[model samples]
Target: MESAVEQLLHSGTIIPAHPLALDQYRRLNENRQRLLTRYYIASGVGGVAVGVHTTQFAIRRPDINLLEPVLRIAAEEIAAAGLERPFIKVAGICGPTEQALAEARLALKYGYHIGLLSLGGLTAHTEAELLAHVRAVADVIPVFGFYLQPSVGGRILSYEFWEQFVEIPGVKAIKTAPFNRYQTLDVVRAVASSSRRNNIALYTGNDDNIVADLLTTYRFHVNGEIVEKGFAGGLLGHWSVWTEKVTGLFGRIKNCILEDYKGAGALLQEGIAVTDMNAAIFDPSHAFRGSIAGIHEVLRRQGLLEGTWCLEDHEVLSPGQTAEIDRVTAAYPHLTDDIFVKEFLSQDSIKKLLLHA
Candidate 1:
């Protein structure tokens, strides 16, 4: 890993899985997409993950062919920002080995810092086959392993799979989003046992358990030594909405760790509040059928998106989901970044930021 990239990853920061911005026709909305990128950069996110689950996997369809375009837009925006510090850019790579390698190369072409490799769709492969696929992609660019929850299109990867995963020299980080505690522990312990344990950063993808994951230290007895690990930060769909607040929350969590704060009571309460908001936005009542749309709805409500449009017409919010969003927005107004977004949009230099040079 490049020194800067390695430093940032280990230090931990908020990385929102960038969402797709589409017109009513379900075509890419370049202007709004650019604006969304500016919003994230302005909101203090350390990085952005494009072409990921929140961006909609359907965009890769030949007829749509949005993978490169979306990646390019984000790359342009980040470059245009010209931040003095390193800003990690993560491009999501999916599909079988051949396609995953192609996407990894494409990500490197666009100046992405890492490829967030999703093994969700390859359900039939054996663990050995899966590891081979992972190694093939990592051979192209550094890899961020994704343990997507089975509720989505993900399969249950054994601890053995991750044990081998962390041993790969090109593996840089892992985002554990199994949404299951036991499964999350599996990934953590696997890394803990690896020779490169310190080299691989563990980021929490568990939206339901974000605060706790960030706060609790994971200790393991490995090879006659005690190893401690904790989530450095999150690469989350939940963080994609209310981003400014999300950054603030992460900073507070970081402070707790650095100060060795003993007060868990208040932080635990905040975690429940965040999880409650996630339920509303993630729409767990419908098995996450509305997950992407739920995220779009929040952005749309904040004027970050035009509408809750998705590539597939049937992918709209589940019935009663809008009401649930309404409930949470009303219930936890502090968690939303509406005011920050409003002021950001009103800035005199907004036009310059949105210009497609």
Candidate 2:
């Protein structure tokens, strides 16, 4: 296992447009192609976020560095499952500064081509320090600045904040969950107006308006904060619900959004199907674990893993909740019938689930 200082000091050169990176992008394209083959039309792009906690078991057993190896295993598993282009985000809200940085570093070193950084903890820092951190990580991996929703104690980053940070050496993307549609669009406009055109990507994490926002050039806001135009992609948070189903539909979803397809609501419904189905299985009483549990619960039902672990003491979903999860999967219609749950559910259970899946 690489020490933190060793990992930090090793200035690994990023191969410019490396075959591996291009291969990854190509693999994503292939995944889309497979989806078209499956449905005759592309759906939307689907990406999954594998939490670090899920990999703890693997790290502990192998005498490996906890975060990096886990991320590598998860990425390989996601790719093997036909989600060749899974977007991996470090479990930011709960991770410490060192852990977050190490995870991001491992993500770059391993196959997780994209990185997510927390905006909540960031906003607490001065703009200068925040930009410095963003620049530092961006140098190694393509980073998507994560702005968690306000409900999770998130904050609003100003246009100037983005203006400065976007210029950082390696920063390339922004993830904003504007509580309201207005604020959501505002983030879109801000990214569009930024100096970097195609270089910088903007992803609206506000699921409610993402479909509609993609159709228009400008992201509209209730506050009348009609910002500049921005290209949309990278639905990092949406992955928990639609991981496998998304493999074959991302292109369709992108086209639907761009073409202003009429059945947008239905599209949302289709995407929401996985989330809703999973939610029905674990919600309310299981809220103690919060949405992270929802992510694990969905993965478990999909046969990704046999069990889950709550990172924090307060976040554990009750045993009754776990039983209910099993019940939900048992009762789920065609979704669970013959689906093979993958072995690389986490670092700890990788060998087990991989053998089974």
Candidate 3:
């Protein structure tokens, strides 16, 4: 299975950390969720990740039994999509070593390719303890390190931690999303410093710096020589919302990298506009209190969501979030794939897609 993770790193592109859909019952919305998975396939993401923060993992953890059922539905839909390349499936794993190991085993049992392992919950412990915990989970499934931003329950991880983490046998990738350039570079340097440096893949989860992240390469001095590397791709929550356009941006960036279109100096040179819209959608003004809500609101307008319903009521949009969503959607109509979402929102349309598959 090491070859499987290696394969994803080598050839796979964007892997959206997809959002979870709940029915009016506040339980899993099977059909609508399946439709969302198919939409990602048609929109062109090379992989999909569920059971992450954006997928409401916290709420699902209490009733852990619910997690696998929801995941099974996603696995079913991904199998039905029938793409030319395999859509790498990533299941999120968090909590204590035992809990994370259980989830990792579940991911492997269901044919998931990797576990997006989170270390936030264990921040209170020593690095050695955390490393032991991580190794325990790695024993079950190949795990991707998730250095999430503190704004959303993620704890800060030191360079020392990452230096040792990359040495772990089953740690195959790292999703650097601390949103701090210094922290991001720490993980990059740590990976480049490792014995498995060439084998480990680094992915960006920095929604605010997506274009720049994908466009830049990192350089490091290790073992008396210079080493260079760049993010293999992304596994982002932001991509879950504006999916179609995100996929297109991915294509443009890839073309620029492949053809050496250095005439403009940087690929998608005018990508600031996308980040500007992110500023609004991500609600930087309110310390991102409305970030998740903003994404839900955007999906609501596209008819993908019935309303902005989160697992917890307080998690709903903050005041004025809707206006921000409205402003961004109108300001950059091209960024919203509402038309594409609406086209398949109908039950009949999804049925046809499934029938063909």
Q: What TM-score against the true fold does each predicted structure earn?
A: 0.97, 0.61, 0.92
Q: Which candidate order results from sorting by TM-score in descending order? A: 1, 3, 2
- Residue ranges of candidate 3 with Cα displaced over 4 Å: 2-5, 61-65, 261-269, 351-357
**Best-fitting candidate, measured by TM-score?**
1
Report the C-alpha lDDT of model 3 over 1-357, residue by residue, as the tens digit: 646446866554888777767766677666667777888888888888888777776555565346787678789888876766657888988888878888888888778988999887676889889899989888888888889889777877789999999999888889998989999999999998889887788899887888888888788888799999889898887888879888887887877778765533544454676777777667777887777767777777776766677676666777777776777778878877877776665558776644533
Error of 3 at 348 (Å): 3.5
Which of the numbered candidates is closest to the native, going by highest lDDT?
A: 1
Candidate 3 deviation (Cα RMSD): 2.7
After TM-score superposition, what is the CA distance of residue 204 in candidate 3 from its true location, in Å?
Answer: 0.5
Worst-scoring 10-residue span by lDDT in model 2: 13-22
Q: Tens-digit lDDT track for model 1 on 145-233?
A: 99999999898988899999999999999999999999999999999999999999999999899999999899999989999998999
- The number of clashing residue pairs in each candidate reads 0, 20, 0
Q: Pairs clashing in candidate 1?
A: none
